[model samples]
Target: MELKWTDTLDIAIELDEAHPDVDPQYIRFTDLHRWVTELEGFNDDPERSNEKILEAIQMTWIEEKD
Candidate 1:
């Protein structure tokens, strides 16, 4: 699936699957941004993301972890 900044859940799942050992709650936004952009099928503008969007993605990722 092609991912965008709005695809928070999918992105979260991808991240969770890719980095199962890492805790989403403790991740830095900078690292998150880089990881999101690096994800396969991620086809959105990297510059489109901001703190709020990243927070949403992180929150979703946390939920996915549980």
Candidate 2:
């Protein structure tokens, strides 16, 4: 499962991601998920199936307040 942008998997952006206050918006979301997958090494193991990923995502029933 290589991470990449596909026409079916992406949405149109109304505005260009350009900001000076913090890291550029392009860097923020561009290949954003790719980095997460790489860091988690989710693609390295063939035994760990999608069901494992689903199990990993515990439904966040609790909310945090500031």
Candidate 3:
């Protein structure tokens, strides 16, 4: 399934799986933005994302990690 900016939880899951060695708690928004756009099945416009969206994704990723 194609991923969108609204797919925070799913995106978090993908990130967790894709970067198993990375710590989501320490990731910067800039790198997070790049990673999300590069993810497989991600099809949302990168420009549509804001700080809030990135925060949600990061929070979900942290949850996934734990």
- Can you give the lDDT of residue 62 in candidate 3? 96
Q: List the residue pairs that clash in candidate 3.
A: none
Ranking by TM-score: 1, 3, 2
Top-TM-score structure, candidate number: 1
Ordered by lDDT, highest first, the candidates read: 1, 3, 2
Candidate 3's residue-wise lDDT over 3-63, tens digit each? 9999999999999989999999999999999999999999989999999999999999999
**Model 1 lowest lDDT segment of ten:** 1-10
Clashing pairs in 2: none
How badly does each model clash, as a count of residue pairs? 0, 0, 0
| Model 2 CA deviation exceeding 4 Å by range | 1-24, 28-30, 40-66
For all predictions, the C-alpha RMSD in Å is: 0.4, 13.0, 0.5
Model-by-model lDDT, in order? 0.97, 0.25, 0.97
Local accuracy of candidate 1 as per-residue lDDT tens digits, 1-66: 899999999999999999999999999999999999999999999999999999999999999999
Q: Candidates' TM-scores? A: 0.98, 0.21, 0.97
Model 1 regions more than 4 Å off: none
